[model samples]
Target chain A: MKKYLKYVVILLLIPLLIIAGACFYPERSYAFVSLIAVLLSCVPFFLSFEKKNNSTRKIVLLAVMTALSAAGRFIFAPVPFFKPVTAMVVIAGMYFGAEFGFLTGALSAFISNFYFGQGAWTPFQMFSWGIIGFIAGLLSSPLIKSKILLIVYGALAGVFYSLMMDVWTVLWMDGYFNIERFFGAVITALPVTVKYIVSNIIFLIILVPLFEKKIERLKTKYGI
Target chain B: MNSFKNLNPYFLISYFIFVLFISIFSFNPIYLTSGMLGALSYCFLILEKKNILKSIIFYLLIFLAVAVLNPLFSHNGKTVLFFINDNRVTLEALIYGAVLALAVVEVIFWFKCFNLIFDSEKIIFLFGKISPKTALVISMTLRFIPNFIKTFRSVNTSQKLLLKNHRLKRYLNSFSAVITQSMENAVITSDSMNARGYLLKHKTFYSRFKFTPTDLFLLIISAVLFILTVIGRTSFTYYPEFIFPDLSLLNCISYFSFLVLSFIPFIFEIKEGIIWKFSVSKI
Candidate 1:
C-alpha cells in the first residue's frame, strides 16, 4: 500500500515540473506552454515500462480525477457558489498528500481550458489553483480528521482561493495594478469574493468530515 | 512550410527583439501601420482559414470602437476635427488610437502564429540554457491548471449531494472541503517527486531535437536583420522637425524587407497546408 502511495505521489509531480518550465519561457503564450506541459506529463503514466505494479490502474484513476477536475470549472462554473472543482482537489489532497493535491489542483485548471479555450490567463489559473492545493497540504495534520478543524480549514481555503483569484485579476487588469486603482478593483471584485468565501464555508462544513471518514476507512482497509 | 524551414528559431527570437526595440524608439504612425499590415497579411495567409475571418472581424470592431471613442476622450494632437462642449476632438488622437489598436492586434496575431509553429519542445530546447529549476517550475505550473479544476468539480458535486437546501450554506461548506482536499493531493505529489529524484541537480529531457545547417544559416540572417533594423530605427531621428527629410528608397526597402521577414513563419505554414491538401486529394 505504501509502495502504491509512493507511485501516486510521483505521478502528481510531473505537472509541477512542466509548469516550472513553462513559467520560464515568456516568449510563448503561458497557456500554450502550460497546455503542452500538462499533455507531456501524461506520457510517463501512459508509457512507463513498469506494468506489474498496478501502474495502469493508478494512471487511469488519476487521469479520470484530472479530467473530472478540469470539467468542474466549465460545467457548473461555481459562478456564485463554491468553485466546485477546487473542492475536489482539496479533498484529494487531504486523502492523498501534498504532491497529489498540487498536481490535481494545477492540472485540473490546465487541461480544462483545452475544451473551454486557452488564453493568456491560463497560467494564472494554474498558479492560483496550485497554490490552494499546496497550502491545504501544508496545513493538513492528523488534526484534519477533527470535524471542526476540517470545516475551519475548508473555509480558510475558500477565502484563500478568492484572494488569490482576485490578486491575479488585478495583475491581469491594467488600471488595477496601481495602488490608487487597486481599492476600486477590490471593491468591485468583493461580491464575487464574498460568494467564493461563503460557498467554500458551506462545502467544508458538510464535506470535510464525510471525506475524513472515508479516507480513514480506506487507510485501514489498505493497511497504510 | 519551406519559408519557415529556411527561417530558424533564432530568426523568430531576433525578430521579437527587433519589434520590442522599434516599439520603444520609433513611434511613427506610418511605420507602425505598415508593420501591423505586414503582420496581419502574414497571419491571414498562414493561419487556418476558418480562424482568419473571425480574427479580421474582431480586429475591425476594435479598430472602429477605438477610432470613434478616442476623439471624444483625448483632447491631444494638432489636427482638431470638432468640439464637444468646447473641448476640441482631435483627428490626430483618433488616427493615433486606431494605429495603436492595430499594432496591438498585429502583435497578438503574430504571437498566435508563433505559438502554432513553436510548441513546448522547441521552447525548452531554446531556453534550456537557463536555470533548470526555474524551467521546471514553469513547466509544472503549466500542467497543474486543468488537473486542479477537475478535482474541484467532483468534490463540489459530492458535497452538494449531502446538502439539499440553503444553496449559499452548501457553497460555504464545500469551499473548505475543496481547499483541504487539494492540499492533501499536493503533499502526496511533492513526496512522490522527491522520492523519484526529480529534484536532482542534473535533470535531462526525454526527447531530443537537433539544429541543422539550415537552422544555422537562418539564425545568421535573422541576427543581421535584427541588428540592421535596430541601427536604422535608433541611430538617428529625422522626425517632427524633418530637417534631413525622412523619405528615402533605402528606408522603404529596409522597412519592406523587415515586414516580409516577419511573415516567413506564416508562409511556411501555408506551404505545409497546401501540401497537406494535395496529399489528401491524392488519397
Candidate 2:
C-alpha cells in the first residue's frame, strides 16, 4: 500500500513540476525551459532509487543513446526516408517497451525544438515523435531481431511520422483542405524524408551491432 | 465534481468540432473577437473565484511582450503606423498579432480546463477500444516523461555534492548523468513490465465513469444549441456592417447570454468549493 501510494505521488508530481516550470518562467524561451525541466526532473529517480550492477556502464550507454538520438533529430531534420531518429527510436523501443520508447522520442524532439524554436507546432511535434516511439515498441517482437526487419520497421515508422506531421501542417495552414495542397505538402516533405533515410542508414550501419553486442555481454554477465 | 460526471461525452466531442469548424470555416473578426471575449471573461471569473489573479497578471505581461516584439520581422501590412528606416511598422499588423497572441493563450487555457474536467481516465474511457494500443501507449508515454524528470533532479543534486569544485564541469557531468540514469531506468522498467506479460496480450482495464439520464439531457441541449449556433452563423449577416463592428441591442444581449452560459460550469465549480469549505469549517 505504501509503495503504491509512493508511485501515485510520483506520477502526480511530474506534470505539476512541468506546469510550474513552464508557468514560473514565462519570459524565458519555453523550449529551453522545457528542456531544463525534463533534465532536472530525472535527477530524483537516479538518487532515490538503486540500479543493478554495472550501473555506471548502463548510465553511460543511456547518455550515448540520448545524444545519438538527439543528434539524429538535428543532423537529419524531418524526413520520410530512413531517418537517424527512426533507427534509434526503433532500437530503444525494441529494447525497452512502448512507454519508454515514446518518452525517448518525445524528449528528443522537445529538447531539439529548443535549438529550433517553439511555435503553434510544439504539440504536434510531441505527438509525432510519440507516435514513432509507440510504433517502434509495438513492432519490436522476437522476429524483429533481424537487421532487415528492424530497418524495414524503421523506414515504416519514418513514413508514419512524416504523414502525421503533414496532416498537422494541413490543419494549421489557413486554407480549405484540397487534394492539391495535400499532395503538395507530401512532395515538399520528400526532401526531408530523403535526409531522414540517409541519416538512418548511417546510424543503423554503425550503432545496432555495437549496441546488440553490448547488451549481449550484459545479459551474459548478469545471467538474464 | 459529481455533476460533472453527468456531462455527456458527445457534448465534449461537439465542443472540439465547433472549435475546429470556427477555426477552419470562419475567419471573421467578429466571430474571433466574440470567442476571445467569451473565453477571456470566463478565465477572468475562474481566476477571481480561484484566486489566480497574480498568475494571470504575470502571463498577460508575457503575452504583451510576445505580441509587440513579433512585428519587427513580419512587416507585411499596407497600413503603416510609422516608418522605422525603410520598414513600415503597421498598426494593422500589431493589432492582428495581439489578437493572435490572445487566441493562443486562450486555447492553452481552454485545454488546461479541459484536462482538469475530462482528465486521463475520461479520455481512456472514451477512446480505449477503437485504438486501445495507441491509448495505452499514450498513457504510458505520458507517464514516463514526468518520471524521468523527477529522477533527473535528485540524481543531479547528488552529483553536485560529489563534484563541488568546478562549475562548467558540473553542468556537463549533470547532462551526461541524466542520459545515463534515464537509460538504466528505462531498461529496469521494461524488464519489470515484460515479466508481467504487458506486451503479450490485450490488457483488461476499467474506469470510474458512470452515465446518467441527466448526462443525456445535457448532451441533447448542447447539441441543439450548437446546431442553432451554426444555422445562425450561416444564415445571418452578423458582421461587416461598415460602421466599427456595431452590435445591435438584441445581438449584444445574445452575446452576453452566451458569455453567461459559458460560465455555468465554472460557477457551479466555485459554488461547490465554497460549500465544501463551509462544511469543513463546521466540522
Candidate 3:
C-alpha cells in the first residue's frame, strides 16, 4: 500500500502544480508544464528500478531490446514512416511489466536519437512511445490472448502516437496551446498519420508472433 | 574534449537550461533576440562551414512558417492586419508568432551544440548519479546497436543462400531468426554476469568529466546572468494587449546580461582560438 501510495501522490501532484504554474506564468507555462510533467512521470519507475539489486541482467536485456528496435529503423529505411520499433516496444511491454516497458520505450527513443539527431520532437516521441508500452503492459493479458485485439491495439497506439506528436508540433510553432492551430497541424499531417498507422499495424501483425515465441522462451528458461 | 566543452556536465546542462527556460517562457523580443544571436553564433563557430548556409535557410523557413501560422490560432491584441475565416489576424499576433518562432529555432541551434558537447560518456556520467542502471542501459544499447545490425545482416545473407525467391518471406524469416539469436545471447550474458560476481556496490561509473576552476567561474557567471534575465523577462506581459518593454536602466542591463549569457560559449571559443594561435606562433 505504501509503495503504491508514492506514485499515486506524484501522479496527482503533477497536474495541480502545472495548473498553478500556468496561472502564475501564462507565456512560459505551456512548455514548462508539458516538459516537467512528462519528465517527472518517469521518476516513479526510475526510482523503483534504482533500488533493486541484481539489476545488471535486467539492464543488459533491456539494452538488447532497445538496440533491436533501433536496428529495426535501419532495416526498414527503404520504407518511409514504416519502422518495426513500435512493434518491438509493444512486445517488450506485453511480456515485461509496465516499468520495464516504459524504460524500454523511453530509452529506445533517446538512444536512437543519438544517431538520428535529437530535437524538440525527441521528448515528445519518448513520452508517446513510453505511454504506449506502459499501456501495452497493463493490457497484456487481453492483447496476448487475442490476435484481433492485438491488431486493434496496435492501430490505436499508432493513432495515439501520431496525435500526441502533432500536439508537440502545434505547441512548438505557437507560444501557447492553441486549439485551432493544433487542428490545422493535424489536418496538414494526415497523410503521414496514415503512413504511421499502416506501418505500425503491419509491423505488429508481422513481428508479434516471432517476438512472442522468442520472449516466451526466454522468460521460461531464464526466469526473466 | 575541447577546453570549454570539457566543463562538468552539470554546469553545461545548467547553462543550457537557463537559456532554454528564458527562451521558451519569455515572449519578450529582447530575450528571444539575445538567445537567438548567442545560439546562432555558437552554432556557426562549431558547425561545418558547408552546413551553415543550410541551417540558416532551415531557420528562416521555420520562422516564416510559424509567423504566418500564429495569427490564425491566436486572436489577441489590436491592429488587425487581415481576416481569415472570421478570425482577426492581428499585427501583435504576427509579432508573437515571430517571437515564438525565434524561441523554437534558438532551442534547435543550442541542442545541436549540446549534442556536440555531451557525448554518450557525459550522458552516462550525468545519469549515473541519479539512476545508475539507466545510464548503464543507455551506454550498453549504444554499444549493442552495431552488433545487432551485424547479426541481422548475417541472418539475412543466410536466408538468401537457403531460399530461391520470395524476398518478403526471406526478410521476415531473417528478422525472426535474429530475434531468436539475440534472446539466446541475452540468456548467456545473464549467466556470465552471475559468474563474474558483479559487486553489490562499487564505482560502476567511470566518467572523465572533471571539474576545474574554469567550470566554477563559468557557473557563477551563468547563475548571476540567469537571474538578471529572468527578472527582465518576467516584468513584461505579452497577452490581452501589446505592451512595449520599458527602456529602463534595469531592462537594458538585464538585456546585456542575457546577451553575455547566451554568447558565453561563442566568446569562450574565440578566446581559446586566439590563445592557441599565440602559443603555436611561439612554438
Candidate 4:
C-alpha cells in the first residue's frame, strides 16, 4: 500500500481533485487545482526518503543542487533566458532520483523567486520545473545512457515548462480555458519558448557530462 | 505591545493565504476594488515609501497593459467601443480587461506583502511543524545559494588567471569545478550531520515561536471571515456578463464582511500606530 502511494497520489487523487474543481468551481478552479497539484507533488518527494538510511546525504545533496540551480540563473543573467537551471535540475534528477529531483526543482524556483520577485506565477513555475525534474528522474536510466535522448529530453522539458506556464497565462487573462486565447498565447510565446528550448539543449550538452561524471564519482566513493 | 508583524506566523500565513486566494478568484468590481485597496494600504503601511511608489507604478503599468491589450484579442461583449483593423473593441470587454488587470495587480501586491511578511525564518518555522527534514532542506538551500555564488566567482577568477582566450570554455570549466567542489562539500555536510545523529527516529526539534491567545483569536476571526467571503464570492460573476448578486440585506452584509476581511491587516497596523502614538504622548 505504501509502495503504491505515489502512483495513487499522482494518478488518482490529483486528477479527481482537478475534475471536481472544474466541475463545481470552474471560475476558481485553476489556482485551486494547480495549488493542489503542487502540494501533492511534495508527497512523493517526502515519501521517497521515508525510513531510508543515508537520508541525510540525500537531503544535503538536494539542497546543494537546488542552490546551484538557483544560482545558475544568476550566472547566465548576461544571456537572456539562457540559464542552466533546467540543466542542473535535470542532472539532479538523473543522479539523485525522482523525489530529490522534484524537491530540488521546486525549492530552486521558490528560493530564487526571492531574487526575481514572487508573484501569482510562482506556483506554476514551481510545478512546471518540478514535474520536469520528476519526469527526468523517472527516465534517468535512458536519459543517462543516451546523449541524444538526454538532449531531446532537455528540449522537450523547455517546451513543457513554457506550455505549463502558458496555461496559467491564459487562465489569468480569460479566467477560463479559452482554447482560442490559449492558442493565441502559445503563438505569442513562441519566441521565448524557442529560446528556452535552445538554451536547455545547449546547457545540457555542456553540463550533463560534467555533472554525471562528478555524481558517478561521489556515488562510488560514498556508496550513495 | 503586539503589532501586525508580531502576529503569530501561522495566523499571518493563514490570513495572507485566504486573502490572496480570494483576490485571485473573485472578479466582481466591488471585490476587486476592496482587494486592491486593502493590498495597497497594507503595503504602504509595511513597505518603505519609496518601494510603495515604485511598486504602485509598476502595477499601474501592468494594469494599463492588460486594459489596452485585452480588447485587441477578446472581441466579446455587447457595447462596441471602437474598431481597429476591422476588430470590434467592445466596452464591456474593455471593462472586463481592466477588472482582470486589477485582479492580477491586486494578487501581485498581496504577494509582495506576503513575501515581506514571511521571511525565511518564518517559512522554516511554519514548515518545521509539518516536517523537520523539509525545513532543514529549505534552510540549507537558502544558505548554500550565497555560498555557491561566492565559490563560483572565486573559481572563475582563479581560472581566468590560469587561462586566456576561450572565455566560454573557461566559464564552463570553472562552473564544472564548482560543481565538483559543491558535490564534495555535500558529502562532508552529510557526514557531519550523520556524525551528529541526524535522521534519527524520535528526534526532537526546537522552535522559538509560541501560540499566544492573540494568535488564536486572530486565527478564529480570519477563518470565519474567510468562510463568509467565500460564500459571498459564489453568487458573484464577472465574465460573459457581470452579474452581482441582487442588493439584498444578506448580500450587503456579506459584501461589507468581505471588505472588513480584506482590510484586517491594515486595521491592525493602524491600531498599532494609534496605540504607539498614545503611549509616546504619555511618556
Candidate 5:
C-alpha cells in the first residue's frame, strides 16, 4: 500500500491536480507539478542504489564520468550547440547501467549549470538527460552490439532532449501547454536540435568503441 | 543568538516550506502583509543593498505588468471597471492580479533566501541522510570536477605541444587521455578506501551539521506556527466577486505566526548584530 501510494500520487493524483489547476488557475500548478513529478521519479532509483554495498568504486567511477561530461560542457562552450555531455551520458548508461547513467546525466547537467547558471530550467535539464541515459541503459545490449542502433539512439536522444526543453519554454511563456507556442518554440529550436543530433552522433561514434574496451577492462579489473 | 545558517537542515527546510506555503496559498491582506514584510526584511538583511534596489525596481515593473495584464484578459469578476478593445475589466480581477503578483514576488524572495541558505555541503549532508551512497557520490563528483579541469588543461597543453597543429585532435586526445586516467585513478581510490574499511559500517553516516538544542526549539516553534497558519488560512474567492475575509481571531493568530515564521532569520540576524555590538562595548 505504501509503495503503491507514490505511484498513485505520481500517476493519478498529479495529473488530476494539473487538470484541476489548468482549468481554474492559468499558470501556477503546471510548472511545479511537472517539475516535481520529474524529480520525484528520480528518487526511487537513487534510493535503490543506496541499498547496495561495494558502492564506493562505482560511486567514484560515477564521479569521474560526471566530471567528464561537465568538463565536456565547458570545452564545448565556444560552440553554439555542440556539447559532448549527452553522448557521454548515453555511453555511461550503456556501460554502467541505468541509475549511474541517470546520475551522470543529471549531475553533469546540474554541476555544469553552476558554470552556466541555475534556474527553473535546471530540473528540466536534469530530467531530460537523466531519462535519456536511463533509456540507453535499458537498451544497453542492443546499443552496444550494433553500431547503427548506437547512432540512431544518439540522434533520437538529441531530438528528445531538445524537444523536452522546448516543452519547458512553452509552459513557461504561456500558462498552459499552448500547442501554438510549443510549435513556435520547436521551430525556433530546430537548428539547435539538429546540432544536438550531430554532436551526439559524432561523440558516440568517437567514444563508443574506445570506451567499450576501457569499460570492459574496468569491469574485469574491479569486478564491478 | 544562533545564526540562520547554523539551524538544522530539517528545521530550515520546514521553515522554507511553511513560509512558501503561506505565500502561495492565500491572498488575504493579512497573509500578504506578513509575507511581504517578512520577505522584505530577509532580503534587506541578506542581499546586497545594490542588488536589493535593482531587484525591487525590476520586480516592481513585473508586478505592475502582471496586475494590469490580469484584468485585460480575465473578465471573471462582478464589478466592471473599464473596457479595452471591447473586453470588460473588473475591479475584482485587478485585485486578484495584484494578489497573484504579490504571491509571485514573495515566493521569488523566499527562493532567493533558499539559494543563500542551502549551500552544497548542507545539501549533501541533508540528502546523505536519506541515501548515503548517492550523497557521497555527488560530493565526490563535485570534488572531481575541478581536478578534471586542471588535469585536462595540463594534458591539453602537453598534447598541443606534442601533436603540433591539430587543435581539435589535441583536445580530443587530451579528453580521452584524462578519461582513461581518471578511471584508473578511481580503481586505486576505491582500493585504498576498501583497505581503510570504508562502507563496512553502513548504518553510520558522517555529516558536519549538528542539530543543537536551539534548532529543536526553533523546530517546535516552526511546526506549531506552520500548523496554525495551515488551519487559520482564510477562505478567499475571486471568481464572480472578490470576497476578502474579515479580521477574526484565527486569522490574526495565523497572521502573527506567519510574521514570526518569516522573520525568524531576520530576528536571528538582528540578535547577532546586537550581541556583537554589546560585546564590543564591554571590551
Candidate 6:
C-alpha cells in the first residue's frame, strides 16, 4: 500500500489537480496548478524513503544534489545561457532514482529562484527540470552505459526545458495557446536555446564520468 | 514596531500567494498598475537603494523587450501600426505586450519582496508544520548552496596554484574534488542527524512568530479585499477589446477595494515608519 501510494499521487492526484484547475480557470490554472503540482510531487519522493537509517541518508544526499544544482547556476552566472544545473540534475537522476532526481530538480529551481527572483515562470521551471530529471532516471541504464546517448539526452533535455517554458510564454502573452505565437517565441529564443543545449552537452560530457565514480563508491559504502 | 515583516510566516506566504496569482491572472490595466505601484513602493521601502535602482532598470529593459516583441508576433488589433514581414503590428498587441510586461515586472517585484521577507528560517517554519523532515532537507539544502560554492571557489584557487598549464583540466579537477568533498559532507551530516534522532516522531519545532490579533485583522482584511478584487476582475475582459463593466456603485466599490488591497502593504510600511519616528522622538 505504501509503495503504491507514490504512483497514485504522482500519476493520479497531480493530473486530477491540473485537470480541475484547467476546467475552472483555463488561463490562470497552469501557473496556479503547476505550483500545486510541484509541491504535491515532492510528497511521494519524501515519503518513498521511510526507512530510519536510509531515509536520513537519502534526504541529505538529495539536499546536497539540490544545492549542487542550484550552486551550479551561480558558477556559470558570468556566461549567458550556460549553466551546469541541467547536467547536475541529469547526473542526480542517473544515480538516484527518479523520485530523488525529480525532487532535486524541482527543489533546485524553487531554491535558486530566491537568488534569481521568482515569477510565474518559477513553477514552469520546476516542472520542466523535474520532468527532465524524471525522464533521465527512466532512461538511466542506457544513459549511464553510453556516453553518446547521455550527451544526446542532455542536449535534448535543454531543448525540452525551453519548449516547456515557451508554452508558459505563449499562454501568458495571449491568454491561450497560439501555434504561430509559440513558433515566433521559439525563433526569438533560438540563440539562448542553442546555448542551453551546448552547455548541457558540455557539462554532462565532463561531469558525468567524475560524478559517476563518486556516486558508485558512495552507494556501495553507505548501502544507499 | 508592527510591520509587514513581523507577520506570521503562514500569513506572509498566503498573502504573497494570493497577490502573485492575481498579478498573473488579472490583465486589467488599472489592477496591474495598482499592483505594480504597490510592489514598487514596497520594494523601495524594503530593498537597498542600489538594488532597487538596478531592479527598476532591469524591469524597464524587460518591459521594453516584451512591448517590442509582442506586436511582431501577435498582429491582432484593429489598428495596425505598420507591417514588418507582412504581419500587421497592431496597437492592441503592443498594449497587450506592455500589460504583460507590467504583469511580469509586478510579479518579479512582489517575489523580490517575498524573498526579502521569507528567508530560509521563515520557509522552514512554514513547511515544518506539514513535514519536519522535508523542512529539514530544505533548510539543509539552502545552507549547503552557499557552502558548496565557497568550497568550490577555494578548491579552484588552490588547484590553480598547483596547476597553471592546463586551465580546463585544472577546473575539471577542482570541480570533481568539490563534488566528492560535498558528497562526503552530505553523508557525514546525514549520519550525524540520524544519530541526533532527527527521524524520531513527535519532534518539537521552536518558532519565534506568534499569530496575534493584528495578524488576524490583516489576514481578514486581505482576504476580504482579495475576494472583492476577484469579483471586480471577473466582470472585466481584456482580449479582443479591453472592456470594463458598467460604472455601477458595486463596481466602483470593488475597484476601490482592489486599489486599497494593492496599497495595503505600502500603507502598513509607512504607518510603521511614522510610528517608529514618533517613538524615537519621544525617547
Put down candidate 2 lDDT per residue, A186-219, tens digits, no spaces.
Answer: 9989878756655565556555665576567557
Clashing pairs in 4: none
Tens digits of per-residue lDDT, candidate 1, B28-138, equal 555465566656666666567788889788878876765575455446577667788998877666665565465555555655655555555455455555433323433
Model 1 deviation from native, Cα RMSD in Å = 10.7
Which should have the higher TM-score, number 3 or number 5? 3
- Please list the residue runs of candidate 2 whose C-alpha ends up more than 4 Å from where it truly belongs after superposition: A1-122, A127-224, B1-25, B37-51, B58-102, B142-158, B161-203, B234-261, B270-283
DockQ of each: 0.06, 0.05, 0.66, 0.65, 0.50, 0.59
Indicate which candidate wins on TM-score.
3
> B1-283 in candidate 4: lDDT tens per residue?
6667777888888888888777776667777788888888888887799988987888899999988888887887777878999999887778878888888887787887888777788888988887677788889988988888888899889888887947777767777887899889999998999898775668877777789997898889888987877765345554466565788766676677778888998998898889999999998
TM-score for each prediction?
0.55, 0.51, 0.92, 0.90, 0.81, 0.89
Candidate structures ordered by DockQ, highest first: 3, 4, 6, 5, 1, 2
Candidate 2 is scored at a TM of 0.51
Residue by residue across B109-191, what tens digits does model 2's lDDT show? 55444544555455655656555543443455445444544554566578788867575344334434444555555566656
- How close to the true structure is residue B119 of candidate 4, measured as C-alpha lDDT? 78
* Candidate 4 stretches greater than 4 Å from native: A1-31, A50-54, A219-224, B81-88, B231-234, B237-241, B278-283
Q: After superposition, how far is residue B224 of candidate 3 from its true place, in Å?
A: 1.8
lDDT of 1 by residue, A96-167 (tens): 565556666766775565555544456656666665675566666743756666666666766666665554
Chain B structural similarity as TM-score, candidate 5: 0.83
The reply for model 3, stretches above 4 Å from the true place, is A2-26, A219-224, B158-169, B233-236
Residue A86, model 5, lDDT? 95
| Model 5 segments more than 4 A misplaced | A1-36, A78-81, A109-123, A145-148, A166-199, A216-224, B25-37, B55-102, B159-171, B235-243
Q: List the candidates ranked by TM-score, beginning with the highest.
A: 3, 4, 6, 5, 1, 2
Restricting to chain A, the TM-score for each candidate equals: 0.64, 0.62, 0.87, 0.88, 0.86, 0.82
What's model 4's lDDT at B29?
A: 70
**DockQ computed for model 5 against the true two-chain complex using alpha carbons:** 0.50
